[model samples]
Target: MESSKSASDEGTETASKVEVKQDEFSYLEREFTSELFKLEINNLGIFGIGDFKKMLKSLEIDAAKVKTPHKRDCAFICLKSKEALDEAIKKLTGYVWKGKTLSVKIARPNADPYIKRKNEEQQEDSNKKVKRTVESQTVPLAHLTYDQQLEEKDKEMRKVLTAFGNNLRKLNPSFKLRKDEIPCEFEKIKPSPKIDDYRNKSEFAIGRNSNNEIVVGFRVGSYSDGSVEVGEIAKLPHIPSKVKEAVLKFQDFVRQSKFLPFNPEFNSGHFRQLMVRYSEFSKEIMLVPGMYSNNLTEDDVTELKQSLKDFYSDGEGNLVDVDSLYYQHLGKRETGEMFNPVDHLCGKTHITDVIHGLSFRVSPLAFFQVNTAGAEVLYQSIIDLSEPKENTTVLDICCGTGTIGLCFAKYCKNVVGVEIIPDAIEDAKFNAEQNKINNCKFHVGNSDDYIQSMVKEVVYGTLKKEDLDLVAILDPPRSGLHKKSISAVRSALDLKKIIYVACNPKAAERNWLDLCKPESKTYKGDPFRPKKAIAVDMFPHTSHTELVMLLER
Candidate 1:
């Protein structure tokens, strides 16, 4: 009987051990599938792993691991917990790091490797399906008929605009969007008159083509794939023929020389990128050649510059007009200062473009609308929406080159423009002077700083708020206005109207939500209600549309 009892006890102990093991397994599964969260970071350009970690540290986020899949300009970060992941996204999403605005979103559960290799197999299958579809439609883009291309473009625009409208309504439930005023529903997208070769600016990447030939074009997929397609400019409908010719010639010159294309994986090559900007109105062209020059000596750079000058000189190979030329040296650093001194290789230092009867001088690094003609239509839409009074003070935020603010100078009593880039402010002043407009002032500072200062001046009686009607015009970057700037606008009780223009509707919706919130710690004044919104199809073919929202207290 004692022997029987001993055997029974041993069996019970074994079962207890198995139960504990099962409980531990279940806990780990729950931890991974529910407690942890994954985030995908988009538009992460040239940001190294160290920089990404620093960003998370700044936001007080503890990430489990960060992965760069296929060496793309994106990062997948696994956080310790879902709450921490949410906090990191709240602070870092739409944050501009190194001139690239980041878009962060919650990644799928399959993004985690804890689920074994099933997710990887599924992803491979999906990619194969997509590749097959693309291969089936391998016909050259140029062969497509104009009407067919327009139809495809129109369909894409309609889908994107519809999504924008939906996002706006979802974000601001109390604010009513005038259905009749929505441009996408009421007015047809204004197709680009010059559909073929309409782009004024094109930036090309230097790499080895699929045939392993030295080429200057765009990458076919992620950088890790190491596959590039040469002569894409020649096939693309949006690139100008002249620009294509210049790029082809430059590629030939590079092939003849000993310089190598920049290898992003190894970060060891010389040539990097090329930018071409042309103005059809002024008939002027600007060429900027970017190179990784930390390893290159002074003599090598000088020889390269001379080679460029000889190639574009008035003698043998006058590929393009060669109006302006600049060589930019890109250093090996992860910062906003991407370019070194601008070495003027030949011709003028700047180019000019006429917009709405105003001749604006555009520097190599300055920001200008890619579609100059379409910009006129967009600016007119802003004006029509705002309808600035004669005795109004227009505050232009993120005023690049002061074009929008200067446009309002003629109608308003005073125009004050604020831009973060000092060079852009100088350009704005120069533009104002060139146009013989003296009622405008451009300040080099953050929009929020300048707005708060102006508000303080009015409160202290240095500036009279009652003398002029206040109208704010915001043309922020694709990331939209900063939270502080939005708060400053709300605090300015005297401001009567705000015209917010945005290229990315998603980012704009976030700002609009903050503006329309009933009560917030940042904003003290009454919430500004969305009065009207209109979509402008500034980009015809692509899935992008400019939106202008008018708000009032």
Candidate 2:
């Protein structure tokens, strides 16, 4: 009887091991067969999770789960069956959803641990390659012959220009290059005048460096790895020396003080970010100190304010003269409110900068071009490309501080500048008044809303569309214009020319594509074709270059 019981126990153990093995095999198979699709929805304007689900439902796409990893513009859908996934892709790909193009493709199987490991290894290898390339380029060309160095530099410049042209072509295949009214095989690349110290503003974060010492500088790498490097401002050529000195002094003061550097992981400490803005025209400096107000007493605030005043005062350790100083209370919330409840700590409340003979009042939070010299070149190009006539009315969308529109106000009949930031609009108005410019009108609102209202006014006969030759200038943020803005532009019948100034070519390429696409449901009117485009080297020593394209029907 005992022998029989032992045999039964051994049999039970063997069955349990077999069951575990079978479950493991089943999981592996499931990973291999996971039906997931990724959709790169272009011009996904203000789309939330509910909107995405509704769109999927309208298309009869059955998604088990939906994930928006990055921005609301892209979505990942997990379908129950491969057939459903393929059908969804077929129906949505190349289709205009929300007036934007959709790109659908099968997502890589991420359920498999092996696949994740392989991807991580591949990323590390790519990073190593980039590091090696950068290191190789850092070797001074002074060792080579002068002529050889010149040849190498020219070769590198040509390579960059060619790559830029190729990317633009890929983004818009229908776009043709023009050289003196003749179609050219290659687009032109313009060089910037000043390369070093081009940036007018620099923001530094307070953190513990690799040496485990509290420092105020730009972050080098991922914060999770705790690989912050200190005193990097000295190496950056774009940052002015005066700004760097101020940052260094501030770093020292903060380190010596009782206040600690803010740790994002632990959410402790007081110091957050230090912003320095320098004016090339006025030669003035503006300092903005961002700090968290949570867990701070009245005495703590007073002490902090006194410390800042003492640091900037004419004392033994005074690094640079701060023309303006502002204290901003940064909250932990992710809202549109930037620098809530700002207080003027010392000196002036704003700085001044001159662009194309017009002085602009720049608030601490107002959006102004960091590259002051490059901005002059950019504005000149825009004016030349726009060709504003005496009777022409210019519509400047996303006009920060009304610099571009004010420049054109002297040449054009009327200039309407629209900006979303209220402070920027205020600055614009102040600039207009200071400059005694009456032809320009600055509006504080969203570009889309203002554009729609203008279209309505024209339709209602309140504003005669033909009375003034309308020329629209768009200088949107890095994300480019929303689909609604594009639609509003199309709806305007009297818009003769469009001058699109884009800092980020990749994002702007989509807008260009949409504008140039053949007449469809989203775009009912005749499509605008790119007449001329010039690359402005606003940011030198970097791969980024601003492209200004002129489009007309």
Q: Model 2: runs farther than 4 Å from truth?
A: 1-50, 53-66, 69-187, 223-231, 294-299, 314-319, 334-341, 455-466
Please report how far candidate 1 places residue 418 from its true position, in Å.
1.7
The estimated TM-scores of all candidates read 0.70, 0.70
Over 1-553, each residue of candidate 2 has an lDDT whose tens digit, in order, gives 1132343344334324422112212233423333344434445566777778898899898777777776556777777776777787788888787777888767754443433333354546554643212112222442555345444544544454445455445544565533223222224555556666767787788876544667787765434332233334566655677787778877777767666666543345677888889887788888888886564677777888888777777543355777888887765545565436667888888899888888999988778987888888888888988887877778889998999999899888888889988889999999999999998888888887898675454345425545667788999999999987887788676676899998886668678767766667676576787677766767655546677878898
Evaluate residue 313 in candidate 1 and report its C-alpha lDDT on the 0 to 100 scale.
91
lDDT (0-100) at residue 232 of candidate 1? 47
Clashing pairs in 1: none
Superposition error at 439 for model 2 (Å)? 0.2
What's the lDDT for all of these models? 0.70, 0.70
Q: Model 1, range 1-553, lDDT digits (tens) per residue? A: 1132343344334324422112212324523343258888899887667778897788787787888877689988887776888788888788888898989988764422222222243446554643311112222334556556555645644554455556556555555654422322334445444655556777788866644566777655543232223334455656677887778877887777666676543345677888899988887888898988876788888888888888789543475677998898887554565336568888997788887899888877766777787788778877887887777778888888888888888888888888887767888899999999998988888887889776554345425546657778888889988888988888777776888887886667678767767656678687777666666655544446676778888
